[model samples]
Target: MCHDWGESGDGAVVVLEGEVGWLSCSLFSHPSVYNYTSALSTGLNLFWYRLPAGHDLEQPIGYSQRLSKERERLWLQPATAEDTGQYICMLSNKSSCTKISMRLEVLARDQVVRGCEPAVAVAPSQVIAPLQEGMTLDCPDLQDVVKMADSSPSVTWYHRCQKFPTWGSDREQRGLSLQIHVMLTTYDGSYYCTVHYQRRGRELQYSRSINVTAVYPSSLPKHPSILQPTQDHIFKVEQGCTQVRLECRGHFPYLAGDWDIWWTVDGKKVEELNNSRFFQNNRQVKYDYGDRTVESVLLIQNLQAKDLNREYNCSVRNQRGFDTHRAHLEQEVPLPSVELGCGLGVTLLLMLVLFVVYHVFWLELLLLYRSWFGTDERHTDDKEFDVYISYARNSEEEQFVLTTLRRVLENELGYSVCIFDRDSLPGGTITDETLTFVARSRRLLVVVSPGYASQGSQALLELKAGIDGMARGGHLRVILVQYRPVRRQGWVRELRRARVALALVRWQGDKSRELTSRFWKRLRVELPVRRVSGVEGGGGGGEEGGSEGEVALRRLHSQNSTSSQTGLITNTVKEPQKVISIAAYL
Candidate 1:
């Protein structure tokens, strides 16, 4: 008979009788209880193959059931944890066959979340470590861990909302334990754990909070600390002498907020101390308030011999913490005076001559230059900019310049472009006007030809102007391109030391894959794209931190070649683009 056996989980089995030719059983998920089969007698050794769901079993060609009197079931030699789910038993005789059902429940331990008890606790109540130094977190013992389903679960550790670089994810056959190590500041925040369950229907989770404290040596003075102009209490009385201001530096581990500063004179708090002011690390006192300042300075004003003997302490107080520092005045040393009519007069004469020459020549020339040309109009517009291409003439390298520009602007990002041409200069010296442009730009992209850096006067001047502009917070974008290789050395140091150059691109031209990958990495740092306004018919632009746009831009730039005019890079490498044509805008 064509038959099979029901799984043993729902209570089904096979029986054997003496002189019987064969007996077979059939089993499967039942529609009703009518399909249930009775338990089997002790005769045939039932070999049950337990498997996970979707387990692949190498099917036997024919069914066979052998009888064993010593053992009730056939011995599955050296059974593994994998052999622990559900199985079917096939029974057979000479003529026909008999079948039985069996179910295997693998006892696998998932995880043990330390319940009720805090996972970790510091002993000294407060834990402190120097900033950037190493620290540790103690984890509790995992002694009661047991096999829950049929396999063991894993223990994962995390800190500061970031995963620790070093971790353990390996599985052990016999035991389970873990030691979590962390470096301070590198790991400063809440910590938790999650277990990857081997069992089909169970989950493991645990969590705990940790407080990290950073300490520094000999922090700024706190409120209540004494402050004075001189370390020792002594000074000479003098007319028009600037007052000595007192200050207190606050303690380290500064809290994150504004703090109040105050001074204590002769055991009494001094109110309206005009010279004292609050600063980040320390309280400051100015001596010359009337000297010239829109805001009150921290310097003390007026000098008196009696004031030197007095004691003054400065202190700063914040809600989270406070600190004070003490100081005493010392003997005042008078400014040394040389023979006024001789040495001082000679110095005065020289300064007068130099000042007159500077005003007559340098100052006048600067004013003339400023009035003639004025500032470039580009700086008047308001846009946070990243780069500006500043390159000299190279008829041979024009193609390279244009290609690089398009790659950086259209294909790569959302930066504004201002291309300067010598032919477009308005009736003035082109060299002066170009220098003005380089100075106004945020970053200068210098397109260097094979001998561009070595080229005559004007090229060096443009490059120098670009360098000077960058010294005032502007960035430098260098694109050195040439058909013939240029050996970079000596005076051409920056160009030689360029992090990302088109020349390097040509070197790895043979390995296009690696070269392209490196080129994109360099572009990401140099040319970051801006958030684009969502179009009425477009799908994106609602994401935070430009992640949506970044992903889109990455997909666009991964093009293999410049083909169609649509200018869209085929991002077959990225996820299939969801081109949603929205009729409505948000």
Candidate 2:
């Protein structure tokens, strides 16, 4: 037989080789070569043949036929030296002939008795595919083993040391190939393919191991969602130097490099805000279920009013899907600084005005205060006399106060007057009489003359009594009548102190009508109004004395008579001589 070979008419070729332990061959028929032939239109009439070493060249040797269903492949069991020969495949038609051939050289039985190493080369040593994709593991070069042995080997596949089932059509182990319709994580592990054959009537087995690593990409359980700050997703902050935080989260199956979380403001990335007042924080949490969560936070510090109503977006993404949430920042209303300043200014101004009024117009203020809050009318009614007269102890000063002021104020002004000298009982203590009269009178009229201060303790006693009475509830008021322009040097310590608070009057004297003078007006203001009775006598005066010398003599007589009538005299005097004498001087 010819060992050299050539390409067939269709440019198809067959290469077959057999070593001491393996046999393999590949026969390829060019479909275009039979395109026009009717007899072999289907190109299905291919056949396999062998010519033994001693057989006739024209005869075909056929025993234990082994060929692929398409007649495109042929294998044989392990062969001895007797089975070494040429193997051929023929494509025939009525008009043409195509032949593919290979020669097998088998070793002696002793050489074939050697141990079976892994004769099959399974590609690849490792198989990796994503889940849900199809994959195929092939035991290549098995045909070479078949060519040496002259028998096709049976291929079986095992997964994780368990024999893989071929019950489902989707899973198959054909010849030296195992096919899986779809890959799954459950199918990940070691896979072994065992090739069982007979060589020289001896059963032999060989196997190739491979690892199938199925990659299962993580998937999102649900869409991403925002997990915090439930209120309308609006955060309220003060205008100045404020901080706000927002969080976005989502759930996904735990898959490395499969999920991403980030924050954005107004469609701008958070990192882009590094130069601005915004900051970012990120976190991820895993759960017991093959699920996990990713959280993204945005922090805004020193927030401004312009930031109000600005939208912030938090986004979470994965292979399954992506989610985004929106939140708005709002500013709270603040009190205006101008209004606060105005309120403080008004309060201070009012306080200053009150202080000025208290210092400058104190007397007037006191009078006004008394009118509103002083003792009622009942207090005034308790006073027995409207005026208490304190005069100098000297006879001339006494005579002037008794004749002029007492006569004018009591008779003309309809006032009840208490004249200490006249009202005091003989042999009574003067101090007791002074205090008693001062207490009973509503107004104390002091005759402030140069001689009054020279009277020693008598003047002191009278002034002290009046001051004491005024101090007790202020029911009694004091009037200082400057009868004669007394010098400041002559002023007693008590009088100087009391003068600031007392009512002072400068007598214009008989030079003008005393009733119409400012002195009388001011004096009457300090004294309460006098009450009138129906039985009161009309104003009276005696007929002018016969002469100045005669009036002087009668005044002495009238003074003696006034002193003799001490206990509450209703009328001054009924005798013409006394009334006429006293009225003449007035």
Candidate 3:
């Protein structure tokens, strides 16, 4: 998300007091070392920092005669205990950054105490040797003695604190390292090494311990296993795919310790094919238990007729075993020519019909996808209402809202819909609570109509609150729903600004009554992508809910038949718009 500090490498540098010690930047130390001045000439910058022990912050290193920083090496002349800490070398350029850290441990000269107890514990070293194999073990930390004495030191090796007999013991003593003819389980023990060197006209002894471990030639199972291509497999190439890859995986174990899996096509190595179309790649996987697996893929680009019959083989091998698998590529059989000729006319007609249906009912298809696949908005936000209807009261728009729009949104689509007349309760101040409802809702649905914003209504106040909530809180979305056509000049400034960015939907009375009609589909598209679920009075979790198409058809029939529905829309005078008492819905 921010700056990547890049890969870091760490080690330790041990030296003695009153001696000149050099710590080469580990960033440039490959097997030996890299030229730092050459890297600087190539457009890279380097910086050095000192991190004292027990301190969280790093202090930048300054060059001086006592602590000279010459290019990539940090030189400490007459080393002191205070100089013991971590040294970091940072290398960076325009594109990337990296650093290397090394612990600098400065030790003081010790008095000659024979057969003394260990005053300091050295960092334990782990060396792994394969069983029954010849290996070498070096005495560690001799470099510290070399640094202190300014001369190469003599080393003595012991196992379990006893002189290691060399004759007939399968072991030999080198200058500062030891060699074993064969490794056994008994060899897996701590070995001690003592460095004897002359420093300042006096002989000093430095002793440290090293641990060795005996490992199996191959961990767990010894035999290699081939994991792909069951006996006599064939791959049928598809019609449109231009490239194909034949992957072969193998498990290998070896004391020789090399992944022996490879791919050969038609008795020739994939690399030896000499054609640009044939290539192979390999991947190796290692486990914590000291075993590994290798996989190879043979890729064929722009396959030709001659490539179909070629045999592909994957082979795996270890010192213990070897296995190979073979397979072939093939082409699918073609359809009969008679059937293709007879089906051409019918296929064209079917495609034309399908295109027409998709063009006309794409909205219905989108609505279905939303209910089935879209996420619920409540999962991401803390809100009380999903839809808040702010329609003018005592008007034809109110009848449309209560009868059709509110019923469809709440009962059919299972949204948390809030209506001013139905949701306002008797415990809070009406003016403040109504605005609170606006604040709590995620979507503010404004019903614009010829009768909207009547002389005594608070429609304009609610509209202003919705706009302010969207601007300040930034989570609320305001949607304008046109109940009937009105002049552009008649709309409030807030509604005019909103219409500039929104596509307004016009109501067409009975024509837009069907839930699948263009008007309702467009409105549903603008609503939030949400999961539809069972709500109160929704006839939920049963046959009625499962068959939404049938339910919408039933409602349509009820509207048409006056015998089944009451004529309240044309006859009843709207109830005196009730003021809130405070709580049922906001």
Best lDDT goes to which candidate? 3
Q: Estimate each model's TM-score.
A: 0.23, 0.29, 0.33
lDDT of 3 by residue, 94-189 (tens): 876667677887777563222533322355588777777888887675664476574678877777546656434778787677888988777777
Q: Taking the tens digit of each residue's C-alpha lDDT, what string does model 1 give over 328-443?
A: 66654556566645788899999999888876565344444543555522345443334445444454454444455534453344444444441123344445555666655555
Better of 2 and 3 by TM-score: 3
Clash number for each model: 57, 20, 7
* Top model number, TM-score: 3
Ranking by TM-score: 3, 2, 1
Q: Mark the regions of model 1 whose C-alpha exceeds 4 Å error after superposition.
A: 1-386, 422-424, 455-457, 473-484, 490-516, 528-586
Count: clashes, candidate 1: 57
Go through the candidates in order and give each one's C-alpha lDDT: 0.40, 0.60, 0.70
Instruction: Give residue 459's lDDT in candidate 3 (0 to 100).
Output: 74
Candidate order (lDDT): 3, 2, 1
Better of 1 and 2 by lDDT: 2
| Model 2 lDDT tens row, 1-586 | 2222342333222221232233222335344443324424565365566776676663554545332322254544333455566666666645555665666554433432323322333234766655676778875456655664547778878765457683355667654688778766677766766667776676765556677766544332444444554434776666564687776665655444567778777788877765567887777765533356666677877766677756677777766677666777776678798999999899999999999987876655654555455553334477767788887766677767767777666545556677765665654545555678888888888989887744344566768778877787887788898888888878888888899988788777675345655666556556654322211333222211123454344345446635644432323232234334323322
Q: Is candidate 1 or candidate 3 better by lDDT?
A: 3
